[model samples]
Target: MMAMTFSPKFRRVSGAASGESTVRRMALVAGGAAILALGAVGGYRLVAQVEGDRGIAPLANSEDIQVNGIKVDVTAKTGAEARLEGWKLAQKEAWKKLGGPDMPVEAIDAMVSSVVIGQEQVGPRRYIATLGVIFNKARAGQYVGAGGATIRSAPMLVLPVLYSGGVQQVFEVRGPWQRAWAEFQASQSPIDYVRPVGAGGESLILTAGQASRRSRLWWRNVLNQFDAASVLIPYARLERQWPGGPIHGTFTARYGPDNTFLGTFEMDAGSEQELAGMLDKAVQRMDGLYRDALAAGELRPDPTLTTSGQVLDRAFAELRTKLMPKGGAPIEALPQEIVLPSSTPSPVSTAPAETVSVQFASPDAAAVDAALAAVRGVPGVRGAATMSLAVGGTSVMRVTVEGGSERLASALRGQGWKVTSGGGALRITR
Candidate 1:
C-alpha cells in the first residue's frame, strides 16, 4: 500500500518468472503424455503376444507302436473299396514287421489304432499310396510281448536342434525337425525319450545355445524340470540346393551334458515336399545310434552333472590337500607305503577284486551320493561309481569289491539297507 507504483526492473522480473513457470508446466504435461504413449504401445504388444500361437501341439498317441513305410496299391470297383483294401493291406504289412503272428484282416484291424497316410492318390477304381499303420501297444502286447519288453535306459531328454539358413534353433519355432520328433513313437525303442512339447517358457529355455552350456548346475535344473537323467541331442543341419529345390541334411546323435558325439549320418531329400519324411527317418536312425551307444556303456549320464558330485569333488580336494607332502608334491608322487597313515592298518583281504553291478533307487542326487557313500563304507569295497543315473527311478552303479558281490550285499544288509540278490546284480534299498 505504501508503494502503489512498481519500478520497470520489478515489472521485468515478474514477467520473466511468469514465463519460466509456463515452460515448466508445459514440459511436465508433455513428458507425461509421452510416457502414456509408450506404455500403451508396450501393453498392446504384450496383449498380442499373449493371444498368439506360441507352440505346436504334439501327437496325442505317441505311445502307440508306429510302423511306417508300408506301401500298398490296390484296385477295386470304387474308390472307397480300393481305399479300404489299401488300409487293410497296410495293417497286415505292419503286423508282419512287428513279428506278430499272422491273423485275418478283421483281427489285424482290431489291433490297428490309426492309419497314417504319407502320400496317397485315389482314382475312381484304384488306390495307390504310402501309408503307416499304428498298432495299440495294449491290444497288441500279447502278440508281440509288449513290443519286446527289454531293459530300457533311464529317461533321456530329447533336444532336436535344427540348423537352417545359417541359423540354429530348437523349439524356437514350429520347425519340421521338431514336428518329426513330436510325432515319433517311442514305445518300441529301448531308449526312454522324454520329449518336450515346446510351449510358452519351454521355447525360451531350450534354445540351441543351451546345448553348449557345460555348467552342471544349469543342466541339473533343466534335467530335473523334465525328470530326465541325461540329455540326447538329435541335431540336423539342412542345406538347400536353391530356393524350392532339393535339401541335404547332416544329422548327429549327441548325448549327456557334455554333448558327447555318438555318431553322425547324412541324408538327402528330393525337395522341400520330402523334408518331413526325411526328418522322420533321420529321427529313427538317431534312436538306433543312441540304443547302440547305451549297449556299449557310452551313453551313461555324467556323474559330475549332479550336485552331489560337486560335494564329492570338494571333499576329494580337501583330502588331497591334507595328504600333500611338506615339499608341496602331490600324494600320488609319494611312495605307496608313505601314502597311508601309520594309524590306519593295511587291508587284509587277499581275495582278488571283482567288478559287480549294483542297482539302487535314486530319487534325487542326494540319494545317489548317500548310496555310493554307504557302499564305499563296506570293508571289502574297493571302489564304486554310478554307471546309469536315473534321478526319479532306479540307478545302477558298478562296484569293485575284494570278496565279490555277495560279500558286498552282506555288508550292505548289516548297514540297515534292504538288499535283493538276483541276475548277477544286487538291488539295494533303504
Candidate 2:
C-alpha cells in the first residue's frame, strides 16, 4: 500500500497537456495586460484632449477665429485630397464668420494668415474637421469696420479677473477670460491697453484684490511701473448650466484707482465650441464701453498729477518756514551753518557750479514739485532739476548748490525730511 501511494506533485496528467494548458493561461494573461495597457493609454489621451488648450498666444497683428464641425463629402482620388478640400471649405467658412461673407475669394486669400487643425476625421471620400483660422489684423479690421474709431486713449493697465466654478483667479492661472484678453486685437480697439502677459512676480502683485485697493499711492506706484496712466479691471463671472453645456458669462467693466464701475454686459454660448467667440465679442463690447467713458472724459488720468509753479511756491514756503533758523535768524545763525564754497561758477554751468545729487520719494507730481522746491529753497541752492523722475517712487534730482552734499542733507533734515547719507548722495523722504 505504501508503494502504491503517490505525492500530489507527481500525480499530474501528460506533460504535453500540462505545457499546453500553461501556455493557454499565459496567453490569456498577456492579452489582459495588453488590453489594460491600451486602455490606460486611451484614458490618458482622452484626459489630455479634454484639457488640451494651453491657450493660444497673443499675435501682434493677427486675429484667430475657430471654424467648428465642418463636414465635406466628395469623390476624390485619395483621402488626403478630401481632407485638404475640407480644410479649404472650413477656412472659407471661417472668413465668412469673421464678417467677410461678401469678400472676394482673392481678398480672403490675401487676408488669411494660417490655418490650424483642431479635430479631424478622414474617410474614403469624406472628411470632417474643426479648424482655427488666423486672419491679418489690418485686413480683418477693414472687413469688420473696426478701424474707423480713433483710439486716442492713454495707456491703461488691464487686470482680467475670472470667477469660474467658485474660483476667483487673475493671472495666477491661465483662464479663458485671460486668454480672450490675450488674444484680443488691442491695436484695433479704441482703448489703449497695457496688458501684462502674466509673467513673473509682476502679475501676482497686479490682481483682482489690488483692483479694490483705494490707496492712491499704491496705484500710482503700480501705474508708474507699467507706464500706464490708469488701470482697468475687466471682470468675468462664468456660470455653466452643466458640464459641456451652455456657459453664461457676466462681464463687468471697472476702472481707476478707485475701482469705479463703468458698465456690465451678459453673454452666453450654446456650448464650449462657441465660448471663445462669445468671449471675444464680450471683450469688444467692453472696449466699446471704455471708449464711451473715454469720450465722456471719465477715463482721464489722475488730476492730482498736475504740477505748477504755484504748487512749487506753496511747498517751498511751507518748507522754508520749517527749515528757517529759530527767531527769524539767517541760516548762518543755525546750529549747523552751511557755508558757501569759494569755487568760481564754471562758464558751462548755468547756475551754481557745484552739483549735489538729492534723492527723494515722489509719490506724485505734487510730491515731486515739493521735493524740487524744498531743494531750491535752500539758502545756497541756485537751481534744482530732476535728474531722474520716477513719479510714485524714488526720484533723483541734481541740485546746483553753493555748498556740499552734507549741507544739503542738513537743510533737508531741518525741513523735517528724514535724510539718509549714502554713496555721496543726500536721500530724503517724508
Candidate 3:
C-alpha cells in the first residue's frame, strides 16, 4: 500500500515493550533537557550582574584587554557628542576596574559634563590622559557578605571636575577626584582657604606646670582667644644640672624657643651644643635692641654722640672744609652706642678720684690713705680706693688702687712699707 510506512523503529525486548512505558521514558528525557536549559539561563543572568560584558570591551580596534578580562578601549566615530559617548563608554570601563572594595583612586583627574576641551595630558605625556587606577573589589564584596547578598552598584552621584584650559588625567567618580586645572599642569584644590584665620597674626603656645584655674586665666589674658589662639604645649621643659653649676656660665631666659626674655636659666658646658647656641642668641638680644629700633626707624641718636651743640660746632667746621655746598647737612650717625654723659653729671677731671682705705697693713686712716695714694701713683693705675675695714681680728680696709693690678703691691713696698698677699686679695703692713 503506497510503501506503507513505519515512522519509527522499535527494539525487541525480553518482555515486549509497552506503549505506555515508552511514552513515560520519552517524557523523562524531555524533562531532563528542560532542567538543563533553565540552569544555563540562570548562570548567564548571574554573570551579567557581576561582569557587565566583562567590564571593558573594544570600542574600535584596541588590543583585547587581557587584564582581569576587562575591556579597555572605546572608539566611536568622533565628534563632540560621539566623543562624549565614547567617554561614557570608557567611563563604564573605568568604573568596572574601580568596582570592588574600598579601592582608593590611585590617582584621579576629571572632566565634567561641560564641553570637553577635547583631550590633553599632564603626566605620561605620550598618551596624554593616562589615568591611574587600583582596587580590590572581590575582597570588598566578600567582606560585606554578612550585610546581605547583593553587591551595590557604583556610587549614585559623581561630581566630575571640568578642566577647561588644559591638563589631562583619569578621574574617579568621587567628588574629591575632580579639580579645575590647566593643560599639562596640576589641578586647583577642592577646598582652598585663601586666608586662614590666624594667617597674618602670630600665635604663642602656652605651657604651664598644670592647667589650674590661675594658669588658664593667665593663658587667656596673655593670648587672645579670638585674634589668635594659643595651643597647649606638649612636653615639659627638662632641666639637667652639671653637678657643679656651669664650667663657664652665660645664662639667659626665654619663653621656650622664642628669644624674648622670660627669666634667667642656666647654660652650661657639655657636648650639648644647644647650650652654646641658646646663650649666643640671648646675649645678642641684650645688645641688639638698637637693631630692632633701627628697623622701626625709632632710634633718636644721643645729642652728645650726634650733632648736639658742642659736637655740632666741631663737625660743622670739618664738613665746611669739604669745599662742600653751604647748604649740605652732615652725614647721619648710626648711633651705635648711647652716651648719657649729660643724663648723669659730668665729672670734674681736675678733682682727685674718690678714695678709700686698705685694711691689711694699715689699721689707721693715714696708713690706708698712703697705701691708696702710692698705688694710684703707679703709671697705669687710673684710680683706686678701699671700701671697709675688718671688725674683729679680721680687720677690714677699703683701698682704691689707681689701676687695679698686682703691681700696686710693689709700688706700696717701694713707698717703704711692707706688703703681703692672700687669697683673692692683698695686704700692706707698716
Selected candidate, larger TM-score, 1 vs 3: 1
Ranking of all candidate structures by their lDDT, best first? 1, 2, 3
Residue-level lDDT tens digits of model 2 in 132-172: 66666666765665444374876788888899989887876
Measured on C-alpha atoms, candidate 1 has an lDDT of: 0.83
* TM-score: model 3 vs. ground truth: 0.17
| Winner by TM-score between candidate 2 and candidate 1 | 1
Please give the lDDT score at residue 145 for candidate 3. Answer: 23
lDDT (tens digit, per residue) of candidate 3 on 1-430: 0122223443333345575566567667777878888888899975544342111111221111111112223333444444444444444444455442433333111321112222323222122222322223333334222344332211111111212113311121111112111111111111111111111111112212212223433443333222112221111122345543333443322221122232333334453444333333333342243234334433322222211133444455555455343565333322425322223233222333333334455556565545545654554343243445432323444433333435566777778867676664666666
Tens digit of per-residue lDDT, candidate 1, span 1-430: 0123333443343578876666666667777878898899899976664344556666654667789989899999999999999999889999999899979989989988889999999999999999999888789878875533477887788898999999998886788999999888777788988888887778878889999999888997788677677899989999999998999999999988888989999999998988988998999999899989988888877755533343445566667567777788765688987784434333356688898999999999899888987987787665566879999999998887878988998899999999999999999998
Model 3 off-target regions past 4 Å?
1-358, 390-404
Can you give the TM-score per candidate against the true fold? Answer: 0.66, 0.51, 0.17
**Candidate 2 regions off by >4 Å?**
1-57, 61-79, 86-107, 116-149, 270-274, 305-430
Alpha-carbon runs more than 4 Å astray in model 1: 1-51, 60-64, 101-107, 136-149, 307-430
Task: Give the least accurate 10-residue stretch of model 2, judged by summed lDDT.
Answer: 341-350
For lDDT, the strongest prediction is 1
